[model samples]
Target: MEAYRLLIADVYELAGLSRRTSEEMARAVGQTAARWHVLSVLSDAPRTVPSAARRLGLAPQSVQRVIGDLVDSGHVEAVDNPDHARSPLMRLTGQGRRALDELFARSEDDRAAVVDRAGVTAGELAAAREVLRKLAGALRTSVPHP
Candidate 1:
């Protein structure tokens, strides 16, 4: 009851914290969080803007804007998309990979510090993640235009 309500608020609060942390991590690599996110998504493989947007749960236009910024910064490059003529596929450049790798390492250190301070066990974190995933899955299915 009340706990569920509290959980909802906590989730949003956590999201804000996550965004701030991500921004800081990205800043360390001389990039904004938005640009970093787009690069990170493309790190897996070359993907069309729409496909990357879908995977990141971001708007295509927003992702496109970030992609433009990344391209300007030499972090990402656009390649031919065999599937779509207009929608070019994007991939991370060497600079992007290096930036992402540095960000990940710093983030890992920050995470370890936070985990130590919070005294949250790995098992507890795993359980919480599973519960959150279930709720997120349900919400994604039920929400309109999620």
Candidate 2:
């Protein structure tokens, strides 16, 4: 339907813009969006690379590369995982937490500006999020994976 097409187009553009903005914010703290995302997830709790990749809906290989970089920078550390010997859980170190927190602070103002500029209420954002969540679930079920 025409409506669906328009909605999908908007979603596509929004996603691209969001990623660009996120990357910009991450760069301010000497990190990339990919690395920042990994650190953000690990900030909540430790997760193996595969687990984190699954949660982020990203390829394990890509996440692995970012994790490697994070490890080299001493922002993240691998802790032993009882369930999997080879797959160690990734933990955000104090340095990673600080970096993540700074990134969050930087984005907070941008987020506020977006809401004000768009003149959208919190409820509108929530409703839009719910719609997108449902669409993602429907697509997962209806679309065939390669």
lDDT of 2 by residue, 1-146 (tens): 99989999998899789889999998887899898889888988999998898767788899999999999999999999999999899999999999999999999999999999999999999999999889889887986543
Error of 1 at 78 (Å): 2.0
Q: Write the per-residue lDDT of candidate 1 for residues 48-122, one digit (tens) a residue.
A: 888888777888898888898888989889999888889898999999899888888888989999899999999
User: TM-score of every model?
Assistant: 0.79, 0.83
Count of backbone collisions in candidate 1 = 0
The C-alpha RMSD in Å for every predicted model, in order, reads 2.6, 2.5
- Looking at model 1, which ten-residue stretch has the lowest summed lDDT? 137-146
Q: How close is candidate 2 to the true structure, as a TM-score?
A: 0.83
Against the reference, the lDDT scores of all candidates come to 0.86, 0.90
